[model samples]
Target chain A: MDMRRLVGRNFARIRREQGLTQEQVEERSGLSQQYLSGLERGQRNPTVVTLFEVAQALGVTPVDLIQPDNVKMPRKS
Target chain B: MDMRRLVGRNFARIRREQGLTQEQVEERSGLSQQYLSGLERGQRNPTVVTLFEVAQALGVTPVDLIQPDNVKMPRKS
Candidate 1:
């Protein structure tokens, strides 16, 4: 899957897990609901700072938003 | 410290640890050296896609770039 889509999917999943709506996230992150919706749909590319703010609003680290659940660390030789 | 500065510091540290310079990373990541310098200085905010590409060029995951080394995951209750 595309990295952008992966990040979006992770964001949506985390947000849902927190039981927060897009509107609620917007209020906390100071981002527009339209922007958040676009992000959730993988139609938008957010800056690192924006991601930090969104993660903060969702009570997660930015890494959580970007890392797909299935990614495994490569084994050291 | 500000999150942006923290990210920039981490990026510079990791790049140096990999023994790669901005010019070298630029050649691999297809990002300009000036932009990379700005990013490392916390003067530029990169999109998540850009971060993903940078991480790929560095042989690391995007999460590695964003997560501070000292950050500890909260213990499960």
Candidate 2:
């Protein structure tokens, strides 16, 4: 499913919606701007911890960054 | 939130629901059972790629592994 691209796409979309820039997210997430750039570009793969940190920085959940763009899949717990 | 524990909980639940064991997942996901055990025990921090691999092995999406156990948060994309 190309999760790297999916996460990058969602991250860019959500950051824009929140009116946040990469620099702002870098500050909030305690992740380097370079790394954030790589992530947004789908050039870097992040750990679950990194995903959680970025989500918190963006004021969202980890799932928010990884969900499919088309449909909301059903989940149990 | 503690994402490691969340992923672990979700992983175990979904694996059991699918009637698959660690061995089966190892075969399907190409992840070592030792690593999967640590992941299920909340002792390992996995990358997004690993999460996606495990999700695929379980017949679920990456979001399913990281979603909160309580509420199904609303998503835009």
- Tens digits of per-residue lDDT, candidate 2, A1-77, equal 77788889999999999999999999998999999888999887888999989999999988889888988678879
What's the lDDT of the predicted structure labeled candidate 1? 0.87
Give Cα distance to truth, residue A14, candidate 1, Å. 1.2
Count of clashing residue pairs in every prediction: 0, 0
lDDT of 1 by residue, A1-77 (tens): 47778778988999999999999999999999999998999988888888889999999988888888786889999
Q: How accurate locally is residue B44 in candidate 2, as Cα lDDT from 0 to 100? A: 85
DockQ values of all predictions: 0.61, 0.69
- Which segments of model 1 are wrong by more than 4 Å? A71-77, B72-77
Query: Residue A32 error for model 1, in Å?
Result: 1.1
Among all windows of 10 consecutive residues in model 2 chain B, the one with the lowest summed lDDT is: B64-73
Off by over 4 Å in 2: A72-77, B72-77
